[model samples]
Target: MDIAILSVSLNVHSTKRIVEEGQKAGHYVELIDHTKCSVKLGEGKPQIYLGEENVTDEFDAIIPRIGAKVTKHGAAIVKQFEMNNVFSTARSLGIMRARNKIRTLQIMARKGIPIPETLFSINPHNIGEQIELLGGPPVIIKLQEGTHGSGVILAESKKSAKSIIDTFYKMDTSILLQKYIEEANGEDIRIIVVGNKVVASMKRISDLDDFRSNVHRGAETEAIKPTAKEQFIALNATKYLGLGVAGVDIMRSKKGPVLIEVNASPGLQGIEGATGVNVAQQIIQFVEKNGHRSRK
Candidate 1:
């Protein structure tokens, strides 16, 4: 089997692991950097070129390793692959939807999936009332399209929340403010959902004085199987979001486990290391299964 991966940093740990796993499974892998790739739609045909080479070549399947920031170009590259009737670990639309937190949450809520009381208002004038609607001070402000906990801001005071939200709006940044779960203690569970099951779960704990618990934000992780309810939420959230592979963030609160966000391209380092699970193998298995069907 020959596989191609579209990613920004080919040397990243996750991309490296996927390549290694595919090779271990006796598959040839090519890690293509989408940022450096060019696309052309003319001359009665469409083609994607990677550094002067027409990559319209055939392959067993594709594994998209897109980051939240490079979603546009990455999905476009994956879309070209799909047009050639190639299977992907995740669909382009799923990758785009998972990149945007606000849209994903709206879809989840509509699907009857339980999430934290969330508020998203584009009108900066409604910031005060939106905060009140979501409960009060201490709300989680998240940029609509950011990853790795880089765009999350926890506002504790009403005045501070309003000011920060206004600034974000002034800058034309899309964001959502939700009821902050104090009982969560700046910790959350990352449930890796592959296909239809939760492959592994990890408890992401924040560093001292930090509100975000992402490993990128100096968080620690440990292997822990989530409860039956947590597992249900994890699975349903993925299904609701139409994600093939994802990292579903769940916040444990007094009410119950409420979903925070669904990550389409979840990192493998922390989750795989914490659980001691060969997640890349599972992903390859899933891809091969689908590839088999496509071949049929």
Candidate 2:
């Protein structure tokens, strides 16, 4: 089978790993830089161009490693592939929804998945009320599209929370407020799901001075086996999001395990290193099964 890994660069760790694993499994794999891809419409059937080459039907499957900054255009390329009947690890709509925090949370909430108390508002006038709605300060202020904990801020007091939120709103930046789970102790769970199976999971502990537990934020990781409830939430979150591959993040709050985020293109380095799992190979096998089935 021929595979396309839709990513910005082949130098990225995840992209390299996927390519290596695909070749090891006897599949022809290549990187299609989504940033360099264009969609042509009208005239006849719609076509996608990678530079000057028409890539409308070049592969059996696509594994999107779409970056946060290029999600809009990246999803468009993936959508074009989908319309041409190509199998993708993540659907275009799912990629779009997962790129935005509020959209993912809304879908999760509606699907009865456990999540933290989250609120989103664009009204600058009701800033104070919005914070109060989440039980006041010490809340988390996060950019709707921020990744790797870049725009996630923890306000320890009502005054700071209100000030930070007001600044973001004044700048017309999209943001959301969530009830901070202090009991989590700067830790969270990342469960990697391939197809319908939970392939790997790990606990990320934050740096002593930081509250965000993302590995890119210098968090330490260790292997973990999630409980039945955690596994249920992770699996269902992936399913409802229309993802064949996902990374579901959950925090242990005083009440229970509440989901924090869902990653459509989950990184393999951290989870793979922590759990010693051949996650990249699992992804290739998943593609082998579904890609062939889709062709049939």
Candidate number achieving the greatest lDDT relative to the actual structure:
2
What is the alpha-carbon lDDT of model 2 when measured against the actual structure?
0.93
Q: What TM-score does each of the candidates earn?
A: 0.95, 0.98
lDDT at residue 19 of model 2 (Cα atoms)? 99
> Global lDDT of each model?
0.87, 0.93
lDDT by residue (127-246, candidate 2, tens digit) is: 889989998878999999999999999999988988898999889999999998999999999999999999999999999999999999899999999999999999999899899999
Model 1 residue 276 lDDT score: 95
Off by over 4 Å in 1: 43-45, 293-296
Top TM-score hit: 2
Q: List the residue pairs that clash in candidate 1.
A: none
lDDT of 1: 0.87
lDDT of 2 at 119: 95
